[model samples]
Target: PAEVPAGPYDALLEAAASALDANDFDGAVQAYKNVLSDDPGNPEAKLGLAQAELLGRVQGMDPQAVRKEAADNPGEVNAQLAAADLDLVGGHVEDAFGRLVEAVRRTAGDDRDAARLRLLELFEVIGPEDPRVTAARTSLARVLF
Candidate 1:
């Protein structure tokens, strides 16, 4: 059998996957971006990049602190966002979605927009096909308009 040559992005793809597995979100994001620079619209790289970016934002955050801040100040958009991120990372997907949705409902103008944008990012992190995203999207739309 003849040996096949490796694709240019193969190593980078592997590196990105490894980085993601190790929770090295910055490395994964960079590697995924490198792969994307070569092969635009690559699904794996796109998804990996989204995941990495989401994880990177919450990298050094303390979940308990975030939750407490949100609890202490429900109207604070940043605190709510951090709490939602913690919920998502902790596998409380519905809780994360609900938090953002409530934020969207309670806030106005730029604060509402910020919460909505964060919710969309969480949708990406959860993948478009997720039922939670679908439900949240509907709820978000209701709140927006």
Candidate 2:
């Protein structure tokens, strides 16, 4: 990656991104939270927080904390993705679908791809003709086909 302007907490953010890339998600989350506490409106910080929270949820932990973050900071793609995934994990398929849809509305990024893949898998689980399956199919087709 080309060099970019240093963020407010360059050292901590670098540490967090490195930890996240290394899959030391717990440490990454703490580091991200540290930056967020001081710079709540930072997009990079918001993205880190969202991704870290998602990673925690994927590891069978909580994700509710990020829901409000996603709602408040709509630019955080990772949080929206994580929120959608967490909703699915919690058996709230409809809620998860809504989150993914909201994600699509918010960011024109790879998060939509992730959401589409998850929606496809979830559709399989929910079975065809279920409202969730239908919605997911429609949304997936909108982007993928």
Candidate 3:
């Protein structure tokens, strides 16, 4: 199929990016959702909304505490997930992926699935083309199998 040119929603994408840049997570999420409502499969809007929502989840967290909790509870899925989110938002992309991959390795059933799903979501936030995400995907595949 021929690639469709950018249309009217480019403005909404720009607005979402601007809101994300300014730390207005709610605004960013809303703008991205507006674009998604019009273009349901819009990749940029999906990525932006995922990032905005992830940041919103961890916005009020104390990083030091989160990290300590994760470090102290390697088998705790929630702790590890929270720390991984914090790591990604803090620009420690590799660390975030590694942590979640390990979480998947150590967990089973629902816990394992949660870790795996969150890792995939982070992949979207980072974009699949990233080398780090590629490496993480390989690592996740290995651990899962």
Per-model TM-score, in order, reads 0.85, 0.48, 0.86
- Best-matching candidate per lDDT: 3
RMSD of each: 2.5, 13.2, 3.6
- Tens digit of lDDT per residue, candidate 2, span 25-44? 88998998898889876667
**Prediction 1 TM-score vs. true:** 0.85
Candidate 3: RMSD over Cα atoms? 3.6
Number of backbone clashes in candidate 2: 0
- 1 or 3, greater by TM-score: 3
Q: Which candidate should be chosen as best, given TM-score against the real structure?
A: 3
TM-score of 3: 0.86
Clashing pairs in 1: none
Query: If ranked by TM-score, best first, what sequence of candidates would result?
Result: 3, 1, 2
Write down the worst ten-residue block by lDDT for model 1: 41-50
Q: Write the per-residue lDDT of candidate 3 for residues 54-88, one digit (tens) a residue.
A: 98989989999999999999999999999999999
Which model, 1 or 2, shows the larger lDDT?
1
lDDT of 3 at 112: 98
